[model samples]
Target: MLRERVAETIYVFTSSRYLEVAAGLIMTPQGCVVVDTLPFPSESRQMYEFARRNCPAGIRWVVNTHFHADHIYGNYLFEGIPIIAHEETRAMLERVGEQALEEAKQETPELREVRLRLPDITYRGRAAIRLADYNIELIHAPGHSSDCTMVYIEEEKILFAGDAVLPVPYIVGGDLNQMLATLQKVQSLNLESIVQGHGGVLLRGEIPETLEAAINYLKKVRSFVHNAVSKGASERELLAWDVEKAGLSRVPLGGMAQELHRANLLYLYRSFQKERLRRAG
Candidate 1:
């Protein structure tokens, strides 16, 4: 895990072992608020230790931005802290968290110790948390997932944009249209920096370009998939659409960006195919 203090009171930890996924901590006068937990127990425990040593006030809350295993798997470490998240997040976790954990543990024995921790505090649309001088807003930004949310420190203009705003926008189990709307919503924010769910943090100067590229990539994917579907293209042919052709690089996230792009292509292709069949019926 790699740790970097993005702001005076905010720290981001990037997991070296897993897709470069990130977790964040926001220190407040009352106590530190954890944004999300790293995938592995060892890394998250390190973050927990860091908070214990640095923040004398202790941890006030744990915010699970979404229900993805990589984001919330280590929630057990926080123990008693009140967890805040979207209502649907809790529902999804309740529906499938245990089965997912069991499957994960079967694949990796290291995950055997992980326990499912559902969010105790949930809301719809949005929620606000005020600790001392910091005003934190949890905005519902569905794209990467239905329950995807972003954590904005109103005073600092820093955003912890869960998986909704990644180096390469992924909508495999998400809505492409929703992803576009969410990207537009993010573009409207006056942010000093954006801490992505994966990869490096986006500074002020890098925000606009990064967002525009993602937006453009999604648009291109939609168009390409729709056109291919209209022409009765086979799934294999649609899957052959290259990431660079959609105006995105295959380099981010240590070349995992290419794989994410492929997944997006497959998802959009199937969605367009379904739409066509519905129209024919």
Candidate 2:
């Protein structure tokens, strides 16, 4: 389920999961620039085919949004293309990528033979690539992971937000405050459409509303945990806080809502403790 469309010189490859999540290919007279390889090798191959069929020219630039397995696991599919990523992403890939590869191999033994490749070019803060027709800006948005970046095509008013702007919980290990701030930064962009890492594309006007919902959700979780902690509730007691109170019980987050909620609470509690200690100091 991939949707392909040409917006000026850029080709948008949107996923079918409610038309959420998308990768982009910017065609230049020199070559093509690929943004965020898909999760699986098969999907990466499909993307490659999509590019070749559409552009005929080869890919020369591959920009990875982060070190998440679902985002960069398809690096192997690109073979000789020069892959790029944030410096933090490079570090994470070097440290945890092999472990993730091994885990994937256990599920799909055929992938065992393929080795994970780290990015060749890494930048901190910001980086930009000037294609023949467009300038693609990669801005670091590290709350989601110290490595997450948002890809923006200034000419097209389109943003490939990676996992940083999903409608669901800001998972992938994040700092709640930092995540909220990052969402605010994204909201400030002059975007026409936001291609999220999951869920369908969001219109520009919808950015603030969606982001506020996510932020409010996080704030509610934090408040819930704080009150429980003040009451001297044990971790078990806190964990038992009703989902209805969290306003997420009916969201159909599969069966993992409980697990995610538990994790979110733990993270919030730890963050709260850290802030309290800083104030005490």
Candidate 3:
């Protein structure tokens, strides 16, 4: 795991082994707060140890930005603390996460040690965790997933944008419209930077251009897929839509960006096909 201290009390941990998934730690006078966890316990445990050694007050809470296993699997390490997330996230974990874990363990034995830790504290729209000097705001920003949440530190103006914001907008099990709306909402925030769920942190100077590129990529993919589907293009043809052509670089996240971009195009193509079928019916 690669750890970088973004601020005086804020630390971002990126998993070097898996898709560059990012996690965060916020130190306060009261205690420490873990934003998310890594995919493997080995990497995640490093984060726990770092927090224990650095924050003498102890870890008060574990905040999951979403229900994705990559982000919440290591919650087992912080078992006692309050794990918070959007209500939908808890529901999704119960309804889908359980089965997914069992299947994952079958393929990857390391996941056998993981236990699903549902968020004990769940909110509808927004919630806040007030520390001595920081107010951690949890805002519902469903996009990458229906249960997506964004963690914003009011004092620092740093947003831990789960999958809601990434190098390329991925909507495989998510809604394109919702993702677009959420990106617009993020654009309106007075953000100093953004800790993306899957890549390096976006600094203040890179914020505007990165966000604009993501927004454009999402819009471009949707329009391209919709047009191709309208013209009755085959799935293979639609899948050929290059990531670069849609205004996104395939180099981010160690080339995983291209794969995600392909998935987005395929997802949009299928959704457009479904709409067409419904209209015909």
Candidate 4:
């Protein structure tokens, strides 16, 4: 139900589950291509129904931005469709698909009867999917997640940036440097709009500035965490460091953003320690 027509033939749907997880649908002459599927089965079904009513042609393909649970839980509902994603995405799903489903089952009764499904088509590096009127270029951009890929609709001049772009950029176990690098690369592309997985949309003029802002945030976090690590800061102290005190603006994360941020700090700290140990050895 959380869906909207963002453009002439493009529709976006968000799941109410959490983080307002978004998926996109592009209606083409041949058929419809779904960018990502919602989290809950019911919500995802509704999304499909809406598409079916509006789009007479059946689905041509389903693309997963990443293998994250929220973005991929509805793969079952999309049976027989050629599900496509980055090759690494398929690996991640194969590695953790069962475990993620089990955990989700424990979290909500809605997921109790759900089954995990994976990508049928996988590509490494990049791929060009030729649609009837548009060309979708799947760029494997690893940052927010190792399997993350940005889908650029050529003719429409819109980019469906998966988890690679967020309202408040969040880095889990991904490489901080790689995140910045990918953002910079995406900035150079000529695009009219960017549809993020979370936090709605970014228009043409606002795109560069917002990408820079996100890059700056990641840089500030990395610098602060690095400095803290250099000063004999314990893991607890590193985790407790305030982002605001580090001169970064507060972002809406339901307070759990701090926990994730701290976890990022921990990841950086561990990386630093490993490097130092290697040098010492």
What's the C-alpha lDDT at position 138 in model 3? Answer: 94
Per-model RMSD to reference: 0.8, 3.3, 0.8, 1.8
TM-score of each: 0.98, 0.85, 0.98, 0.93
Q: Give the Cα lDDT of each candidate.
A: 0.92, 0.76, 0.91, 0.83
Worst 10 residues of 3 by lDDT: 262-271
Model 2, which residues run further than 4 Å from truth?
6-21, 240-261, 270-281
Itemize residue pairs with steric clashes in candidate 1: none
Lowest-lDDT window of 10 residues in candidate 1?
235-244
Tens-digit lDDT track of model 2 for 1-281? 56666466766665542224567787777778888876656666788887777666678889999888777766877888899999999999899889888988998865665678899999998999987777889999877777898899888888888878765565437777777778888878888888777655777677777778777777788788788666767788888875556765535334444565677787777666777778889
Output the worst ten-in-a-row residue range by lDDT, candidate 4.
Answer: 246-255
* Candidate 3 global CA lDDT score: 0.91
lDDT of 1 by residue, 164-269 (tens): 8887899999999999999999999999999999987999999999999999999888889889888988878987878888898888899998899888888888
Higher-lDDT candidate of 2 and 3: 3
**Global CA lDDT computed for model 4:** 0.83
Comparing candidate 1 with candidate 4, which one achieves the higher lDDT? Answer: 1
Q: Once all C-alphas are superposed, what RMSD does model 4 give against the true structure? A: 1.8
Candidate 3, residues 106-171: lDDT per residue as tens digits?
A: 989988999888999899999999888889999899889998999999899999998888888889
Clashing pairs for model 2 are: 19-200, 20-199, 20-200
lDDT of 4 by residue, 1-281 (tens): 47777679998887766777889999988888999888888988898888778777789889998999889888888878899999888999899899979987998989876788889999999998887868889998888888898999888888999988875566776888889988987888898899888767789988988888888878888888778767878888887776555444556434555555667777888887777678889
